[model samples]
Target: MDEGCDGTGLCIDTGDGEFMEISLHSRNSFERKKNPSQDSGFEDRGSKSKKKGLSVSDFLTRNLFSRKAKESEDDAEQGWKLFGRIPPKQAPDKDPQQITQEFQNKLRSVAQPKNSKKSDIEVMSTTALILENRPQNLPTKDPEEAEKHRQQYEAMVEAARKKELKELKMKKKQKQQQLKNEDKVVCAAKRWTDEILPNWETMKSQKKTRELWWHGIPTNVQGRVWQLAFGNDLNVTNELYEICCSRADDRIRMTIESSEIYGNSETSSEPPSSKESSVELIKLDVSRTFPQLCIFQKGGPYYDLLHSLLGAYACYRPDVGYVQGMSFIAAVLLLNMDVADAFVCFANLLNRPCQVAFFRVDEELMKVYFHTFEEFFDENMPGLYSHFKKHKVTPDLYITEWIFALFSKSLPLDIACRVWDVFCRDGEEFLFRTALGILKMYEDLLLHMDFCNLVQLLTKIPEDISGDTLFKHIDTIRMNIDKKRFNQVLAVNKES
Candidate 1:
């Protein structure tokens, strides 16, 4: 037999022409079969063989190649790199016997002394367990980078806190300034109303008062000013108002009970006379008037008051009677004054000649007003007038409602009241100027619209109109028609 070594095992060739390889695992059995008495003889033989053929070196070389091949295979299966770098060599796996012995030794090292406390042993074991199971692949952190990130986060938080504080301080400052300005306006208005307004007939400062009136009457004393503006020349008394209210109430009750209600003369019991019809019309208007203000809605606080006031006016004036837009006028008066005072003011306001012509819807007088307004329109804004003529839009279509309502329905309540302030102070002349000013203010838009669009826009006039801007536009208009001039034109038209 001949024996030789390959990287994996030992090869033997038998004389029968067959070869067999010996596994590395047979080393244990081969060692067990060795006799101690024959060891020295084999040792002598091995020394002689090593000198002749280097047998010991050959055996070492074979073992080194086998170990390297096995290691490469293991490394390929488990991956060679860790955390973007080559990993260190792993320790060889231990056998069961070695693992049990190492565990016993570790327990002995961690155990407390025999006389020590049991709690100390438990704490030590817990610490060891945590260290044993903790992950080993995590990379170490840089102290400078970690500290820089922490400081940046703190700086951002501090900056946000300061910004919030600055915004709060700004809001508080603005609110304080607004309150101060309001206080100044209130104090000035009070001073003016108390000192200047009371002695106005003999005062030469009337022009200044008129200028201030054009700006706006302060809300605190607007009612008193309106009362003084429209003086009660109709001689309307509290007794007269109470009498009218009583007649209205009797008519309303009789009508509700479906009984015969008397007309102007108590002798005739006709089918719902003018006064009764006026009450029904007033009922329809009371709920519809100023629907945005809850006080005017049916069953609201001022609902019954508005109804009674309008009903009394209808009973008091059957010739002019309670017109469709009259509720808005009376409602404005009611809001600023008491019921009796409101009735007096309402009666006197309707008594104005310009107001009477419009309330009656008199065609001849309306024609004269329209003629004068058209003359002003052409004189002030010829371009818009030409556009209106192109679209067949006449003054009667939009100007009628504007004059009749006193702009109450067309403009926002606050802006309309401002217009009324100027209108009351200036007279019928301001009405024509205001109409022209409206056309002038919206001239750009009106220049581009068709007939239907122009009529709708002019009749309703948009609520978003700026009050300051509108007044500025109105002030720019220069008209020559005063109340006297308008009356003379109307007389000439009537005579013709």
Candidate 2:
């Protein structure tokens, strides 16, 4: 709901304790920012989220972008480090040269679905009935008391009906507006599709693909862009992917044959081959992947595809085998690319020179990732870093999945995909940049939290958050990380 905390905690009551909160107000704060100096102080405002429990907005009330009273220069620098540079000043809208501009042209042709205006009809007279606790001694046998109870029940029912009707109308109105947004999205997607695919050779890297990606990739065209960002063609990548899949298929048959002939019965001399064991393990994590999304429902085609991709990768790179978080990354890739293409991308990611170490659980290279995260956070956001340190909230508690899954598991889908768009183009620093981005977005709130609340709060992806908002910081704050230092940190730690 809220964006960022302004480094000050506000006292709030929730969960049976008095806690201090220092987070941005929810979605409404975006509007508050439109008129930053509206003269309404803290008491007139509270969080705008309908989500139950104490929200992040109880304390973060300042408009990081308010014009009348802008944040101090230091705060502005910190905001940039956390979220990206402030948005450019709004240029006054000029009269369109033609009535049919791109966004307007896309929507101008679509008629609003019929009866959409009926949502505004008011059911204005439902009286809310308040029925407080009464003594048990009151006799229901009394006619007056019985009649009073009956009226109260009827009024309550009417009130509930009124509430549901109002909400339903609101949902319908929102859906209509969403359809309009969809048209604009389609128009924009068409432009991006033209840039990458049909004209790949011209726009591959000779253009500002990174800047374009940072803006946001149209979901439909994002996968093709990802391939181009990696400087590979679809044909070559698919070929390598298919080869890996064939090898894994062979391995699977061998594993099955060995199992059938050996008839383990706890008496076999050799244990199952690594590939066989990995298949069993992969099966376990397969179902756990994106259980919430319809596309990844258990026993579905997409789920099976995930099975195929992970199996291919494990067989393709025996040394790495399978890791706990690989399933998440593979699932997201499969959503955007063909199964074979997904496998190739997955393998390349694991085999990346610096990134490959992240798969080594609790090993030297893995430790390097954790160290690099700390160094980046310390360099960019020392105040938030010190607060995390003060509370003893270690990186192991949260950064593991972040490094390996690249926030696909914890952040909003669009946000996670945007991160991947950048990751494919920019390399490992993108991960660190996103890591810092998450912390920067939540630093003020985190400063006021204890360990349990801090970890829980940091791990959730609010359904309503916009990835474009999070990606803004990634573009503004350049995380110039050193790959060589990763090796240095590992070497020094090992010697110590």
TM-score of each: 0.61, 0.59
What number of clashing residue pairs does each candidate have, in the order they appear?
0, 4
lDDT (Cα, tens digit) per residue for candidate 1, span 76-125: 44443323454466889889999999999899978846654442222222
Candidates' RMSD to native: 26.2, 33.6
Lowest lDDT 10-residue stretch of candidate 2:
29-38
Number of clashes found in candidate 2: 4
Stretches > 4 Å off in candidate 1? 1-184, 259-273, 481-496
Off by over 4 Å in 2: 1-183, 201-209, 232-243, 260-273, 294-298, 460-464, 472-496
Clashing pairs in 1: none
